[model samples]
Target: MTNLLLALIYLAFISLGLPDSLLGSAWPEIYPGFGVPVSYAGIISMIISLGTITSSLLSDRIISRLGTGKVTAISGLLTALAILGFALAPNFWVLCACAIPYGLGAGSVDVALNNYVALHFKSTHMNWLHCSWGIGATIGPYVMGIALSGGGSWQSGYWYVSCIQLSITAILFLSLPLWRRQEPEDYGANTEESPGSDASSAHPRPLKLSQVVWIKGVKEVMTCFFCYSVMEQTTGVWGGTYLKLFKGMDAAAAAAFAGMLFLGVTLGRAASGFLSIRYSDQQLIRLGMILTAGGVLLLLMPGPAIVTVCGLMTIGLGCSPMYPAMIHATPQIFGREHSRAIIGVQMASFNVGMFVMPPLFGLIAQHLSVGFLPVYLALSLGIFALMQRRLASLYV
Candidate 1:
């Protein structure tokens, strides 16, 4: 029963990832089809991010009423329908409308799933949990790449993903019975071998953000979350278009190559799952920082197409472990009692970065050179590394 339940959670995580990379992969084609400039993708994305922020804010009330099972099941359906709308929409305005529900669905499910995992899994499971998301992220663009490459429309690519999301939603509905842990505050109700499943906050109070700000390492960690999210989200949303505009690749090839970043994420997290057994989260995080920095430098260097592909993948590898490691270490850094509140604060920072920075970059792309993206990535990554070190100086 437990293994089956874990499998269900893993599937939910995968569904969480499927929609995330679609826009970046499809945008090269979508903008022209809508008779809009490439920078307009950020507008749709900002709308989606706003919806996600709204959902995250309201999730406690909604999830308390519906329970995690129902929230996940319904959010699954909502995201599926929203993606289908993306497939069927006639114009950019309709796509903007669809982003609302898609963002809401994604935000709610993300909150529910991560809360459940923190309450019922180990760090290694957390690593693999995100790895499952990596798999879906990788597949989404690959599916989009295939659709575009095969002389099919981007709509066809969305259609394929919508079908997959719908199938997952059905399974999520079917597996609702196994979530006996959902109704209770039994944060310790995980498998016996994995002791100390967290009592993370599902119902948080209005945080006195000013108070936690004084905690020695708090600001640095939050800064890390902010920078890291900006890097990952910006790359996922803009990387393919960067390839097309600068490298002169066709939309199809750029879409496929874009998946390599996520492919590296998927593969890196798979390895992180094993590495977690022997290494502390801080150590793993440091190692990831090195890899990510190296990857960004590779992007800066002029190279052949393969080097560009490998650079993206290397950045992905660097990204893969840091998020899960940071998340998994929350209890240790702040203590389990304070962990939830701080994590909530950290996520708020993450939300702000995701919502603002990517679109800011779009403005830059519109006003300046899209070719500056690699330089931008390198700068963001350097800041991220500095924050990690500062965080370590205080806590790790």
Candidate 2:
């Protein structure tokens, strides 16, 4: 039963990850078809994230009323439908309309699964569970690249991904009983009395940022995550277009390069759990920020295709461990229950960064040069690293 439940959870994550990978890779090809400017693509990307932000705010309450299994099922269906919408969308407006449900479904699954894993699974499982997202993300671009290389349309790639999601949705429905039948002890009072009890108590009560320990550390973490998210999404959302416009890469070649970025992220995240076990979270985070900054610097260099790919990969590696480390470290300082609330607020910050920076970068690219965008990424990451000490102390 445990194994089945874990598998279902992994499927849920895969569903969440596939769209980002596919859309990011295929954006250059699809964007022009909709007859919109490149800058509008960034705004369209935010629509999905905006929906996610709204869903994250309501996830706790929704989960409590509907139960995790039901919510997962509903999200799965919504995602499956949204993928189909993306495939069939006729215009920019239709694509933007599809983003609404896509974001809601993705956000709900993300928060619900994270909360469920933290509450019920061990630390090792938490690490593995997140790695599942990397797996799906990696697959998303790879699949899209193959389809486009075969002379398939962008819509065809989405159709293929939608089928993968539907398959996972079937497995989740089959395994619903295992997830729903939680042991009484799992939710009993004894678990609440544990050292991290205060964290849980923070949840049912209204949110107060003051209740969080390590206010300085929280700020640092937030800044780091915010900067990283903006940089990551900016690249993911715009990299394909840049490749097409500046590098003169064809759709298939561009998608392949984009896949390489996600592949780098996958390899990085897959190893994060093992690395965190060996190093302190603070050390790991510091290293990640440094690597991310270094990667951005590499991107700024005038170089060959190998150098460019290497730079993007380095960026992916730098980003891979930060999210999990931030999440896992939170409970060590804030307690388990409060972790969700803290993360929710943190995610809000992340969304705000994602919402603001991509379009801004797009505008900059339009007015100036694509090469200049990496400088902004470097600056954001450098600031994040400089402030890591303050974030670390928040836990202390």
Clashes of each: 0, 4
Q: lDDT at 162 for candidate 1?
A: 98
Q: Candidate 1 residues 1-396, lDDT tens each?
A: 668878888998988888888998899899998999987987888888788777765665566668778989999999999999999999999999999999888777776666556555666888999999877887888899999999999999999999999999999999887765544543433445333545464344434557666777888888988888877778876878877887677898997798788778888999999998898888888888888888777766775666777878888899888988888777566654455446555666688898888878988898997788887887887888888877775443
Name the runs in model 2 displaced over 4 angstroms.
25-40, 88-92, 120-124, 142-156, 183-219, 237-259, 300-305
Report lDDT per candidate. 0.79, 0.71
Model 1 TM-score, 2 decimals: 0.81
Clashes of 2: 4
lDDT for model 1? 0.79
Compared with the true structure, what per-residue lDDT tens digits does model 2 show for residues 157-212?
99999898888788777766776675222333234312233323433543454554
Relative to the true structure, candidate 1 has a C-alpha RMSD (angstroms) of 3.9
What's the TM-score of each model vs. the native?
0.81, 0.81
Q: What is the alpha-carbon lDDT for the whole of candidate 2?
A: 0.71
Worst 10 residues of 2 by lDDT: 186-195
As for model 2, its CA RMSD to the true structure in angstroms is 4.1
